[model samples]
Target: MKKTLLTLCSVLCCAVLFAQVPATEKQALLDLYVDTQGDQWINTWDLNEAVADWHGVTVENDHVVSISLLFNNLNGKLPASLGNLSKLRILELSFNKLNGEIPAQLGQLSNLEVLALNANGLSGTIPETLGALSKLKQLHMSSNKLTGTVPASLGNLTAVEVFNVFDNDLKGSLPAELASNNNLRELMIAENDFVNTEIFSVVLLSNSGSGLNLKSPSLSPQAKTIIAIESPEDGN
Candidate 1:
């Protein structure tokens, strides 16, 4: 009888010792695999095992913090469950064949710092909900089929250092508020149909310390006039 009690207690202890990751997070990864068609992926997951054992997934303190699957040939839409990774800090899924709109639920990742989704087949407008990511520092969504104007609410990302959305079909004037964020270093929006581009001048002036790489479509004559007015006067 004593042997049976000892064995049962040991089993309970072992279960506690090897507690799996949170169901929400585990399900999030599974959703990603299924939605993104991980079966066709270059590096695929064995869903029967722990998520921590999955490739390109980084976990800390039993929580997922990063998912680096760049150039992995993932083809499909990004699942909404991905936003459940509240502890996620870096999400690098660039250079994939994923399509569909950027999930607004991603704004729930308040701790996110780097969001790299460039070089995909994604289409649709940038979600304004992304402004909720106050900790975000780098946002790369270039070389996609994204359209619509740059979200003015993105100016709320005062911590942002690099913002690139070039080589898209986007149009309309850039948000004037984007200039106030002095932390910005690289602002690439070229190959789009942006107008009233005086915002770039303000960004340059405020971001003097950072190595700013500003790009935009060919400015309209009026925009050129604004740039000329904003330019420093030549010293006599």
Candidate 2:
């Protein structure tokens, strides 16, 4: 009788601890799992288990808040349903084999802070809608096949600190509005084909002491001079 009572108490405790997220949030996660080929992931989730027990998932107040699956061999494209996780803050899926253009719906994640999707096979332009992430801080999309110019709308990310887009095929002038963002710290926009590079000297100069990696051959001599003046250690 004591053994049965103890088992029941344990079950009740586990139930409370693994309280599920809302149906929509749960479904969104499920969509990601399916779209990303979860079966092939380095750390796969067991759907039969509680949402809180899922690998790389963090839940709070019955809402999915964060998902960090970096270098997890996540194959396939990111599901658009991910935007449904309204309370989600961090979405890190770097160094994966995932392909396809980033879904614009991700911009709907208003509460998002860190958006790391680097070192993948992703292509296409960075979505203009991403500028809507008012709370965003770290935006990493480096080492991919992304093209097109950096969206001017991204300058709206006043809370952004580290904006990295290195090792892509992006061109055009760096958005002037980015210069106005006082919170920006690290700006890595190298290994691309951006024109009118001299205009971004201010942006590059500001992040000189930070982890600024602007060594593109396309940079004008004037920009190089600014880099040398601001970050003498780089010896541009």
Candidate 3:
């Protein structure tokens, strides 16, 4: 009986110890991400290793689990190998001076939940490959130089809740498939040159309250509904 009890205790300890994040791995990755920015400083923002002190990046076993690096002076291109941290759940890199188009390789993080890259200087189109992230819940890529129409593939994120891309230079109409995003709550697409819109989902403030002429027959239902709410005078 004594021997059996000791074995059971050992097993339990191992299980708990192997759980999300080994301290060394977490610190290593955190150090790498912060140090990636080196000593770059823009405006009032500056990237410092000390900033990682307030971050909550941790690793499970050998995998990074969560990393929230908001408002850091992280200037430079994102590493192409970032998807290697497969266990990430929340990745918030908003309010940074990061440049370059978002790598399509980032779409490989299937476990990701919240991805916020809004209000930055990121340029390029949203990758259609991001539709593969089945577990993603919140995605905000608003306020950037992101050209091209919104990717219809984003409709695959059925779990998505809050989606916004207001105040950008994105052209083309919203896709009808986006209406399938029933879990959507706050869909902000105001202040853009987007045309040929349709609305069949979501709630929004009437930026113009209907006066749109969606020239595209393929306008998504959600886009049409958004246009319907906008008055003609507000469509400028």
Candidate 4:
């Protein structure tokens, strides 16, 4: 009886220790699983299993760093608790059926580099808090039902190289500060309702082929002349 009791105590102690590393992170994953219909997942995670063994989850030194579950058939609104993954670097949930507004709390991920939540049914405005991800390199949330103007705060992503938010219902003028990001390579904001666009530097679009198409901006005669001079020639 004493031997059995000792074994049970050891098991409980190990479970407690496992739960201690970033309690919020562990609970956040559990909440995400429950909210996103884990039972319907193509390769469902066994909640009883260790964190490292959970499918699509990448843990390093007991810290969740990446969650790449692209096209895994996730079909629900993302839980806000997901922002608690402080060490998260890449969060790719594209090609799913996720809907609803993106959690503003995602700004808390100071270490995030790539955030690809494109090709979903998500709607609502891009959260201003996303600008806080100073380390962010790529931000792709295209082919969605999102509306509202592109937040000017996004210009703060100085390290961003690819920023694609195409085929949406966004309106308003493009922020001029976006050109300040010298690292920017591709900026696809087509098929929207933009009435004005801040003329970007020639260097920014030197390699930007036919994909860059903005509506005729409401500008002065001088501005129009400048645009003609800087515009890349057709079929160039």
Candidate 5:
């Protein structure tokens, strides 16, 4: 009876194996979701299991376009080699313990659309090279330890949508060039020390000018635990 049960179990296992997706297909799925994160914070990405099963991240497909990993508890600095993903269209790395400056190499991704790095422990000034991305749409870098003025060259982004940098230690005035952008929907600069951002037409201008600080005013849902975490209050 024991031998018969073992044989039955073996046959069932084999059947399940044949029904599993091909190795290449599995790799593709993992690669697509390798950096997926959601609205929740505090959960860091530990890809040890994925790495162990597949051995490494594969961003080789030139057709591959988007990669989002926001709100994942991925601590530590980003791997510089990621700059090699030239065909990448979207990249989001917000709300983590990632420190250090934004890699200038990221500017090389000419097709990049969205880039968010908010609510982290990051520092250093924004990279000027980011201005080079022609296809960039949304750019979020708020609620971190980032300092220095907003990148003046960011004015070059004509296709940008959301450009938020609130609740940080950033200083200096908003560059007048940003006002010229025609495609931007939101321009958030609240809870910091922004001087002005009277540029462009913003659908949501939540807190553009003063009264911004590291521990400044409490905009609803700004703390992350709230359900509907929308834009900050517009001081416009």
Candidate 6:
């Protein structure tokens, strides 16, 4: 009976140790904590505690999966180590004070689905590597100071549903490849310096309820035609 009890205790201890995420993933989380000034976060993590006890971090089967830290007072640039969470699905860090260019390493997160970085102070052009997120659904980077053309490579997001880059300083013509995604439902690219808006006319015409919000100073006649078609009530 004594030997059996000792065996059971050892098994329990092993299970407890295994319950924690891998060292690489845990280090990634720690990098995020340190990079984003976790000490200043409204809900800070206690390094002494298990990773499962960390706020906004979700672990499953000892793998870090999702992190939802929206409006959490994260005041620094995102760490490149975030890509180390290979199983990560949703990364919601919007409404924070994070700035600096988005790490192109984020494109390494092949399992990423929802990436919400809106309502922040992030600058620099959207990383072209983001087009590698084949499984991404809702991408929100609006209300930032982003510049340059929308990466034509973003058209590779065949599974994307909502793409919102509204109220930024992005310029250049909208890529026709972007309109080819059949899964796209909500496209908000307003208040920018985009030219050659006619590329989206067919998209606007075919997907009437796709919720496209384009407002540029130089709208082509075809763009105006689609705009008129989208808002018939405005004609009155």
The top-ranked prediction according to lDDT is 2
Q: Over the stretch 1-236, how does candidate 5's per-residue lDDT look in tens digits? A: 99999999999887654444345434443433443231223443244433223222223332335555554565566554456666667666665667776777778888888777777777888888888988888788877888888888888888887788867778877667776666755666666675553333342433433322333333444232212126422211
Go through the candidates in order and give each one's C-alpha lDDT: 0.78, 0.80, 0.64, 0.76, 0.60, 0.80
Tens-digit lDDT track of model 1 for 185-205:
556655667775655543222
Model 1 sits at a Cα RMSD from the real structure of 8.3
- Candidates in order, TM-scores: namely 0.79, 0.82, 0.68, 0.78, 0.63, 0.83
Going through the candidates in the order shown, the clash numbers are 0, 0, 24, 0, 10, 0
Q: Quick one: RMSD of model 2?
A: 5.8
Stretches of model 2 off by over 4 angstroms after superposition: 1-15, 201-236
Number of the predicted model whose TM-score against the real structure is largest: 6
Off by over 4 Å in 4: 1-21, 201-213, 217-236
Give the alpha carbon lDDT tens digit for every residue of 87-156 in model 2: 9999988889989999999999999998988889999999999999999998888789999999999989
Instruction: Give all candidate RMSDs, comma-separated.
Output: 8.3, 5.8, 7.5, 7.4, 10.4, 6.2
Q: Compared with the true structure, what per-residue lDDT tens digits does model 4 show for residues 148-176? A: 98888887999887777766889987666
Superposition TM-score, candidate 5 onto the true structure: 0.63
Residue pairs in collision within model 4: none
- Would you give me the overall lDDT of model 1? 0.78
Clashing pairs in 2: none
Q: How many backbone clashes does candidate 1 have?
A: 0
**What would the TM-score be for candidate 3 when compared with the true structure?**
0.68
